[model samples]
Target: MSLSRLVQRLRHAALCAAVGLMAAVPAAHAQSDADAGAFPAKPLRFIVPYPPGGPLDLMARALGEKVRASLGQPVIIENRAGAGGNIGADVAAKAAPDGYTLVMGAVATHAINPWLYASLPYDPIKDFAPITLVAAVPNVLVMNKEFAQANGIASVADLIAYGKRHPGRLNYGSGGNGSAGHLAGELLKARAGLDALHVPYQGAAPAQLALLSGQSDFMFDNLAAAAPLIRDGKVQALAVTTLARSSLLADVPTIDESGVPGFDLGTWFGVFATGGTPEPVVQKLNQAYVQALRQPDIVDRLRVMGSQAQPLSAQDFARMVAAEKEKYREIVKLSGASIN
Candidate 1:
């Protein structure tokens, strides 16, 4: 072979290697542009699936403050309360998969509704992308101070005694059928051998209203939603519906520790974007909320409202959602609660 020919062959090999390297590394400009425009271009919408003062709503507002500071965009809170969070969840699920839209979802919307409804509109796992879980707030057994004082019902024991004494006479109100509140009441009846009638209302706010109006005897309300009312002496806290005591209500005993021995049930809130949102967008969202949940003030505030922040990665959140769905399936079946 001639020397010039060999030099030409080496030149060809060098050109091929250069092309391969360019292909292996994506274009720098494309990557930089994506990084710059990942998220936070405009104001983001945060939909709360319940009334304004509920635990899910409180978490959305609290986390929104920290997330806006980090993401450099205003976070707007929209209240779409109805059908035990189904109305808002359906709206969020159908929103564009763009990262600008997100919903503060609850166990009732994602896990229990599908099991309870015969023809549910949205598919929880298929229609949303899991972001971090904001917190797990337990249910607190609450009654109007007026009724409690009149009846001398001071604690869980007293409430249980009254319930057993009057089977169909005792009534409890919940957000709606198949809601965490409703299921919690059923669980209480099953465990404590009480014959309490289940009263379903439009939302937690109205259910609480019914309790205060003396339309209902007692209720299991989210601790955060009942916090202000409880603090204001509008309602009395009998017991928290978790096996372990709630940090926010340290003075309140767990239902398990009360008379029921092993009563454990509660609700959790998590952030979710429309399914099919870009993976990078989802990651950015998870990072923002998780970071906010870790902040000292945010963490402390949530805990104070009975929303104990539980930050989780996207994968972990997805796994947790699946497990929660399965767990609630049996609960719904046993309770025989359904909507539409």
Candidate 2:
């Protein structure tokens, strides 16, 4: 063959090989799209940082039902409560990044624990991928009605003033050290300039019991846990810890406006998957949660529990976590709260 003809044939072969490779690329891309579209083909396990019968557990179960219905797969709730919520959070953070395991993370586990614990098993900000901020539950300052009346505590402002005048004489109960209730009380103490001692319990129910029995002067509890008692006149709600008045407790003023300026703390729950989950999967989970939050039944249940349905995008949730981390770092410093 002529040299020019030989060269032409060789170039044509190379061109044909390149064309074949290019044709296979779309087939691979299509397979990936197919896999991403068929997410949650199996059951999903959602880990709650608290045990059953608590606010976080209740919220998880409620939301999990909707997620199951929406995804057409079973969404199971796994409780791994301990270490001020660090144990369960660490489990979720270290879970497989395949979107099968998620965690219902709370303010304590996600925002405060990092600053409170000297050596966390997982990085709060980096170890897990944030899916969405599912809901927000305002913390209520409740005192046993009879106890409050006996102590002549009628209003939140009065309680703070009295506690200041009689420093170290008053003590408040919390779910546990560095829990949301604990941080809320600490924020109150720091803002009100009061010397009230803290009494941490295993959970809010116990804390409420302590307040009822007059073992503690007052208790900071999730509105869900305190609302029924407050309504039945068992406990007198002095104020809510949110910056704005909660619709569930419109009559109760916010602590920020009640005497302690800039006092804002509330327990929040969100969903997160392990880091390295595919972006498409994260988007799918976020959309599912947003839909679940809008369901009428879920909305009613959350509202009755004194929690509001709030949803945010994955990026927005990440930014929210970062902001909370910064805020709580300052709070942990001011409150001198450390797990180690």
lDDT of 2 by residue, 1-340 (tens): 2112222354466467758799686776676567688898899999988779876788789889899998899999999988878899989888899999999987778778888999989888888899988776778998867768977887888897788778778888987877777777787777777678998897777988999888988888888778888888888899998777888899999887887776777777789999888887887898889899999998888888787677777776786777777778877877777878
| Alpha-carbon lDDT of model 1 | 0.82
Output the number of the TM-score-best candidate.
2
lDDT over C-alpha atoms for residue 313 of model 1: 72
Q: Please write out the lDDT profile of model 1 over residues 24-120, one tens digit for every residue.
A: 5567546644864757689999999878975567668988998999999999999998776788999899999988889998887888888998887
C-alpha positional error of residue 101 in candidate 2 after TM-score superposition, expressed in Å: 1.2
* CA RMSD (A), model 1: 13.8
Model 1, 188: alpha-carbon shift in Å? 1.0
Candidate 2 lDDT score at position 248: 88
Q: Estimate each model's TM-score.
A: 0.78, 0.86
lDDT at position 56, candidate 2 = 76
